[model samples]
Target: MSDPAGRLNIQLRRTPHGFACDIGSTRPVAASGLFCGRSPAETASLLPLLYSICAKAQASACVGALERACGMDSDPEARRLRQVQVAAETVREHLWRILLDWPVLSGEEPDRQAMIGAQSLVKRIFGAADPNGVLLSPGCEKPTSFRSVLEEAASTLADLMAERVLGLAPDAWMERVETIDAFDDWCRSVETPAARLLVGLRDSGDGRLGHTEASPLPDLDDGTLAAELRGTDAATFVARPCWGGAPRETTPLTRHADSALVSALVADQGRGILARLGAQILETVSLLRAIRTGELDGDSTAPSDAVLPAGVGLGRAEAARGLLVHLAEVDRGRVVEYRILAPTEWNFHPDGVLASALATLPDAEETILRRRVQLLVMAIDPCVAFDLVIP
Candidate 1:
């Protein structure tokens, strides 16, 4: 003696927050007249459509969720290790520029196509660096001077990844797997770009300040944000402990959709001939890092629930460049009721453009501006394939 129709009374509307989904309604609100209709394929498309750049991740989230829903076992944790391995390779492969290749490419960054050359660089040198895997630190009955060994290892293989970029076989560097036994004999090790860089340096005693070996953490040595991260979470990798007690008072973003706002911030005319491809490189690596490490959780776009909405929904997924978030709502569920915020929105937010007046601010040194800006953009982690840089 129950109304079967009540079970079908599900509502999806374009509220001010995000895609407003009202299912399991206790009160009869005439769902037939106000139902938010979407095809099954449309619903499926929503997941990947929002995160195509990190197709691996998009697929991971979808397949993982679907498998769980269907009671199918993917053993996500088992695959976690291998996924991280692939992630490392993909992150390097996704970079738009090779900063190191800068010196070789006539003091300029290499174009995006050479991105594979970059990740291959990291993989060739660190393929065996995974905690449960092998590395080529040969002939060590008892080993010491980890730095010296790291430097020798990095440089030797860097030369090889570089050659592969030019379409050469890396048989020379590819043969290091033979020494995995000797290297594993040493104490447990961790991986990071800076640590890897130190491993690459050739006999530079008392490694550079940015060299990761000197730090408490291995991952904090390279890129734009390394300096600021010297004593902070942003500086540390996910593998490290996050200090400062639960990120203080994170304000969940709101969905404020004015097509004009989104349209205004977007670059028209291509913003052509920009030299800083490092921004794009960081974005790519960050996404790859997300899979190897963990989900870079932040506020996500919500499917606005009328009753006690979760203030901070995490729209966090690592995109090709980095994390992209759209923290807002769909109150009634439509363009007018929704907000669309992109990563570029914050980085390019017009905070008073006295920026154009400075030919160079008298003491204008590049104060990790590029890194900070790139970090901010990467934090959003948009999946849209279009380039986001303006300068």
Candidate 2:
């Protein structure tokens, strides 16, 4: 209705110290009005249509919350299926940024053809994992023989990443290219635009720009999140979420913070643009490996839904950008309350990671400043279109 996902507005002002940032969003915390009266089944069916980006993740969270609220016991395979779908979606999102946006940032043309192929491959992967398209529905039967589908999809995704983003196989990159020295060599040697962007930032002395001391969001249990969602101040908290009285980041950099590649990058550059870029690449590789191995042990710091009082449930899905949360209240077999806490709210909070990082930027020419801001914003990867104003 309002704009599937609303727009983000970022304004920056040059300061004697560095820069000041103001992040604003038109996204609503309570998207409940649209599905307040729908049945759990109807709500699940409609959520994907309402969310164009990360539709699978949205639907998965919606269904999980609704099922718990409705007192439905889901098939265990259902969770696995959801994981595969979300994992494929994550890979697709990362590839979209690397294959398309990274090139433009590096002063090269977008790899449209590679992106097209990547999209097609992702659809095949999603299709194989969800042949009936009912994976999000409560009590839906898991498709049989989807293992082969995933197997093929895994190989295809790895191959695509190799040619388009990594310029080497994922295993090789992780084993031989993730070290501090080796990573720099890869950036210098790889011909892909992803590598070019990282190298450009390092060579231009902008690699350490946007460094922040913001901590990654800790794993929040469902009960804790559910209590907050049901609290009297739920609306305010959801709009500008903070845990332990401080805003924490939930992005690729946080999700894969433990990876050797990401760790090495962060050690070298702190949690800056270069580290963020490396994290994205690392996550893409890791998810592809998970798909190949048929073991998506889930990477979300937020656990799945847990039912609280009768008819109240909280669901979480680790989306491409970060964690997505949904709170649902069902009464008499119909939806009564629905609220969403999206990752954008946390990462782009007025005092959150992006804001802190922006404050660390070095003063520069207007064009260069804009470029730096763009890199930081892209690293956060907000779902909504962002209008950047620097004055």
Candidate 3:
């Protein structure tokens, strides 16, 4: 299992005009080196144990990379199963952030019942897809008999979204989310947990706080990624992920850039706190819908042959937070190298999303500034515990 105790230490210095923020993240990057010399199957089996936050995504990416290294195609059924697993994991993570973390900004306790319901539903969905309880492995076949269970889970998620999160039926919320005005009206009037939290942020001026120019989406091809891996140490790769020679944001907002709701929020609010939170909620609904309709499968193909070397492979997956990448090199059927590029590395880089957002805040009291920092960081939802120090 992943080291649950990994953490991010955030230091905020009060500059003459504004606060300057720096982050020290202690996520596990060196662990990837342990895969060296392991067989492809051995590496695949160890991935879930190494990454607990998005175990399914990690497993999928690892297996896909290893399969390509071995010149094998992924079984379609296995690919679909991994997609469902990733979707389930994404819904659970999004709900946890929205229901458990967002309320802190409003000085309200989380709705425990709602949290429990969401967790239980996700467990059911994941269990149905992987009844044997094995973390996904390369070529791991799944029976097609879980459709009914998935449907039932979808119905339950729809009810929870309507009753607790949005205070409107899924369809109704979808219709209303198309425009900023409609969304603002809902935020002001709806009593759902999500809406109330957002309204609180607006009232406290935090909705507009922490605004920064949104980073461009990453466009890394396998060849570029392989070259980078060959050129850098694992720690450097994990701590300072950059695309096109610059830091970029790789959260839900960037992951679902095409969503109408997300576009509306970005247009109205920029890529501030409100827009980021809205993107997470919209993505939750989208993933749930895909799960319901059995359309969650992503591209299972390896990168183009020109990019794929005989002994090196790369795999990419859209995790709950953002893109996840795994690269592996094998020689004589033994692993020679492995690297994982997690989303947090990109989003939390010193010059990346969270730091840029923090640097934009106007002057405020220390306590107030700290609270705002807390909310903004939660909105980004790093995978590790963080300490905020203002000195």
> What lDDT would each prediction earn against the true structure?
0.27, 0.84, 0.80
Return the lDDT, model 2, position 249: 87
- Each candidate's root-mean-square deviation in Å? 20.3, 2.0, 2.2
Per-model TM-score, in order, reads 0.30, 0.95, 0.94
lDDT of 1 at 234: 27
Give one digit per residue, the lDDT tens place, for model 3 in 1-391.
5445388889988877777888887777668888999999998887788787888788878887887777776666666777788888888898988888877667878877898998899888888887775536655554454779878987798789888888887767776778788888988877866898888766766787778886865677788777777674655866687776788888888886778877887777778888888888888888888888887665543455556667888887888878888888989989998988888888888888899999988777888888888878988888778888888
Sort by TM-score, best first. 2, 3, 1
Evaluate model 3: give its lDDT: 0.80
Q: What digit string (tens of lDDT, one per residue) describes model 1 on residues 1-391?
A: 6532222122223334322222221222222112123321232345445433343444333332222222233442323432443344345533332334332323233443434445454554234333333111111112122333323444443443333231222232123211223112210132323223223321221111111010111111112222222224421222122213211111001111122221121121111111012223223333333532344332121112222222211122233332232212222222111111222222221210111111111221234333322222222222222222222
**Per-prediction count of colliding residue pairs?**
37, 0, 0
Question: By TM-score, who's the top model here?
Answer: 2
Ranking by lDDT: 2, 3, 1
Q: After TM-score superposition, what is the CA distance of residue 320 in candidate 1 from its true location, in Å?
A: 5.4
